[model samples]
Target: MEPLGQDEIRASFVNCTRGEAKGVTLPAPPSEIPWDRREFLGWRDPKAPARAYLVLPYGGEVIGLALRAAAPPKSRLRSNICGFCTTTHGLADITLFSARRAGKAGREGNTLGTYACGNLACSQYVRGELKPDVPQPYESLTVEERAGRLEEKLHKFVARVLESR
Candidate 1:
């Protein structure tokens, strides 16, 4: 993935209004990110724990999506897997995130949810940069294949977010 500037990241959003894009927190500058090791840039908002974001170079352009995380349960933790990267993590490390569909569907309160890394670190997870204590579900896949699968899943999720009513 190529490094992206702040403006490029803000303009790449397809599922939210321009103002919403501007308001959400963005990842660090490209120079600060480990670009070569990342398949996509993702992060959770420091000011809003429930808010998360993901930006990726898809097709010929970058695509961004804003996600809202469900509040954590008050009871015991349970194991979960990220929908995009399919990486397994402890209960506390996984979150259920939802993205409002684009266009009129969003206005009608339509949303799509998936279990994801709580910190939005699927890139690092798939790259083995952040190892899971337990065996990953994709242990059989090569690192490259795991990254490719992550990208493929991300694209599908983004497409769903951009889909019209």
Candidate 2:
């Protein structure tokens, strides 16, 4: 199947929240992530209505991301290696922030917990080895630019979910 778009993801969020969805699980391709029980690391919560989980698979790289609102404790503090750069920097350099949703994900009025590198150390999508202490290879972009890029990518995926419905 083609990569899920923002719309499809949004619709899934609605169905899940309303209890209309029996089960919605997005599995990582076997080639990227191992086919283990834990491989299904998607979101699941009865209380929250507009949230969804994304299991980004860039090869063996697996980063757990919670797409929900940024109200209070929703902005969590977790430590993990960067999916692109496999550096211990994830502990200090990474900060999970609230992401704005699009389409239905946005319409559902949910927030996204985006785990992003604090600095421009690694490309958000490209696979790389994060060096916490070392300087980044690419020229640094403004926070606005970084956020915009992230939003674009996220919306694309969310849109897929909306269209599926």
RMSD of each: 1.8, 14.5
Candidate 1 wrongly placed segments (more than 4 Å): 74-77
lDDT of each: 0.84, 0.41
Task: Give the per-residue lDDT of model 2 (tens digit) for 1-165.
Answer: 123333343343432443333344443333553223121234433455344455433223332344543332333544554432233452555545443453466456654445444442334322233245545456466644653554455445444444433
For model 2, the stretches where C-alpha displacement exceeds 4 angstroms are 1-79, 83-86, 124-130, 134-165
User: What total of clashing residue pairs does each candidate reach?
Assistant: 0, 27
lDDT of 2: 0.41
For candidate 1, write residues 45-111 as lDDT tens digits: 8998888888898778898888899987565756777898887788877888999887899878899
Q: Against the true structure, whose lDDT is highest?
A: 1
- TM-score against truth, every candidate: 0.91, 0.30
Clashing pairs in 1: none
Model 2: residue 34 alpha-carbon error in angstroms: 34
As a whole number from 0 to 100, the lDDT of residue 154 in candidate 2 is 47
